[model samples]
Target: MSQTAPIRVGRIGYLNVLPIYHPIEAGEVAGPLSVVSGPPAELNRLARAGELDVTACSSIEYAMAAKDYLLLPRLAIGSRGHVKSVLLLSRHPVARLDGKAVRVSFQTHTSVALLRLFLERRVGIAPRYESGDVTRALQGGERPDAFLAIGDEALRLADHPDYPHRWDLGSVWLDWTGLPFIFGVWIARRQAAVAAPQAVAEAARALVAAKDWSAGRPEVVARLAAGQGGFSEQAMRAYFEGLVFDFGPREQEGLAVFFAMLAEAGHIETAPRLEFLDI
Candidate 1:
């Protein structure tokens, strides 16, 4: 690659990723880099198309694309315990979701599939899925008994006190596997990490630094979250404090359990061995 080649970085447009990209946007960190933001699905597409050198992708996409990618070290979109942003909103209780109608977000298939497995294998309920937004599906139509929501939308649901019943998937995953749930992880082209080790290290440093800075400063979080995801001060604070970024050994147990569960449920044909690219 030429020196002029922009190091394309793919990321999701959500509050969960604010720390990873906020510094780049704020000019606190800089180098030969470019940021591309979208939903998890779009990021996966970009990474698969060779349009991105590095991307924070959904766990399912990472497993599917494992043959050609490597995980970025010490970085991820993780939750130590409960993450309110990944949720299941229901008009009825979760126990009543068996064979119930549910609207699913196509943008977040991995989490949805995992939830399905939990309810089936763990909770012993198998629900039917439909394609539609939560609000639209419940608008006097075949209302979704429950809706699997993620990212900024799920955060909004967390703030909805009147929503009555909801389940934080992260909490459920942790409860079952006794580990944190990592929703997104940074992945790079298999060749890129080998050929451009310095660049990869630089990128990892940038992300870690950005994460540290954002964690300590609520001001930065508030500014970025407000404009990027319409996240309020309270919500931003919760996001910054609740989500963990390090993808080190301490979190590997959780990640391993997650991969195993996905494979067992047939969402992933085989569990991909995770290796954090040592920068």
Candidate 2:
């Protein structure tokens, strides 16, 4: 809404995020907008810096947003079960993950945090951190018993015969708590909402619209996926079909559970209430 410049929107550059970002791709000509894409953490930083009007970032980031952010409606990156993107790959058995040094693929704070909370509470393990490649993480380096990898990297290793040690974080959360896990959501700065509710709504609507477009054209959607984002025609179609994109009552329930889990684990000082934007 800043009349001085065109609105700059940031979107996550991951396959799991394609549906939310498809609108930006579709609107290159008519939407008349400037959009940038990057990892969720980077996008969150830009949003905090006022460099982006809106972005799809880790749901936790939005929860812990720096005093001036708003959650948008009817859009999110979440899964009720078997979220192929978020996985825990282990060299040791799942029950014996205690006192283990595990590497978490960077750019996966929300998943890592959630996983850690689960591990500490359920598995009773305090994992040490080793940051690096997903393949290397499985090698169990100096002290790695397991590694947490999310997004495309996790999907690639889902069914490797050599390491039959894959755990879908979403499914795990659901089994344990009977609630869906919300990985990501869209957010806008408070100023942007006040100054340009319409713009915020437009961006949110664009994301929601992209879901429909992406749903109908699996082949085209797969073609748009490129360059090691763990996206193939088969994978894209499965994800689109299996995963739900709309932020409805179910997603809200998921968000509430996420906050509750975070709170129970002492990861958050306070669990903030969420308000969905009508855009």
Task: Judging by TM-score against the true structure, name the best candidate.
Answer: 1
Q: In model 2, state the lDDT of residue 13.
A: 76
What's the residue-level lDDT of 33 in candidate 2?
49
lDDT (Cα, tens digit) per residue for candidate 1, span 1-279: 543566778878887787778787788877567889889988888888888888889877888879989888778877877887888888888888888877788887668877887788888988898766765544545545678888877876664544567888888887877788788788888777766777766776787787777767777677667776766777677666778787877577777777787788877889889866776
Per-model TM against the reference? 0.91, 0.89
lDDT of each: 0.78, 0.74
* 145-181 per-residue lDDT for model 2 (tens digits): 6778777777777776555687888888888878778
Model 2 segments more than 4 A misplaced:
1-5, 28-32, 135-143, 226-232
**Candidate 2's error at 274, in angstroms?**
0.7
